[model samples]
Target: MASRSVLGDIRRDLEAYVGSKIRLRANKGRKKIVEREGVLEGTYPNIFTVRLSEADSVRRVSYSYADLLTETVELVVCTASGKETKFEAHSR
Candidate 1:
């Protein structure tokens, strides 16, 4: 219903950030917060992935657009000119 449409809009907005550097902040419940800087690697119909490197290991995290709408995840995309754009989904 309406939530699906909201998710769709959020997804579309994020699609443009694919292959770009982004900062992610996620809430892991119980007052835990995880933050990372990575490149937005891919986008699917329902989710998107970010690739992060730590030490010698690389991690890929996938999050749904709905997570943004719920404020579970937040993204900040950095442009070539050093401009940053924050993306978060909110009810209209």
Candidate 2:
């Protein structure tokens, strides 16, 4: 299972990937935005899915790899209601 800290790392990496102004959502309720590129890669079992884009100011970025069986990263954004919104980063 992927640890919660992994999400933090991904968030931190987003800032670097998209530059230094990328805003990532902190947990739920609070939407964090940054003007940066989001590059994410992972192994089997542990995938990431991006669910929400906070305020819609962020441009959706996509990429693909030839290693993992799953194409997209599964990022679940927790909402203020303590619910999760699941999203997948797949190649089209």
Candidate 3:
């Protein structure tokens, strides 16, 4: 299990990417994986929000730092130059 400090670090890292484009893959258990593209909305103490647009409908989604710390959520930041970089967790 990840420690509280790890979660804090995750939140700090994500806060830097606020307002950037990103792709995320989240494990929903039972072999289900949800993937989407969105703009990093904001990062809070416990969770971060993303602004997503699908089929002309816009919605927001939130995920906790614990999700990233545990690898339940995989985030890849997209750059304006069309580059993609996966989020790296803090080494144990």
Candidate 4:
């Protein structure tokens, strides 16, 4: 199980990337994976939101920091200079 401090760390790291473009890769169980590109909207105490542009619709989604700690969700932040940085949460 992930520890409390680790989740806190993940939350802090994500907070720094708010308003940046991000690529989200989520594991939906049973060999299913969903990917989307969006902008980090806000970071709250337990979760953060993202604004995404889908096939003709704009959607907002939120996920918990625990999701990153458990490896269920992966976030890749895209910088303006064409660099991609992957966000990771490690339990210690």
RMSD of each: 1.4, 13.7, 1.3, 1.1
Per residue, candidate 1 scores C-alpha lDDT tens digits across 15-80 of 888899999999999999999999999988899999998889999999988788888899999999
Q: TM per model?
A: 0.91, 0.23, 0.91, 0.92
TM-score of 3: 0.91
Q: Which residue pairs collide in model 4, if any?
A: none
| Candidate 1 CA-lDDT value | 0.88
Q: Give the range where candidate 4 is weakest over 10 consecutive residues by summed lDDT.
A: 1-10
lDDT of 4 at 39: 99
Q: Give the per-residue lDDT of model 3 (tens digit) for 1-92.
A: 67778888888888889999999899999999999999999998889999998998999999888888778899999999999999987645
Ranking of models by TM-score: 4, 3, 1, 2
lDDT of 4 by residue, 5-37 (tens): 887888888889999999999999999999999
Ten-residue stretch with the least lDDT total in model 1: 1-10
Whose TM-score is higher: candidate 2's or candidate 4's?
A: 4
CA deviation > 4 Å runs, candidate 4: none
Candidate 1 vs candidate 3: the TM-score winner is 3
* Cα lDDT of model 2 by residue, 1-92, tens digit: 33445544444433332221222322222453333323233222233322224466644443222211142223333344656444332223
Against the reference, the lDDT scores of all candidates come to 0.88, 0.33, 0.89, 0.91
If both were scored by TM-score, which would come out higher, candidate 2 or candidate 3?
3
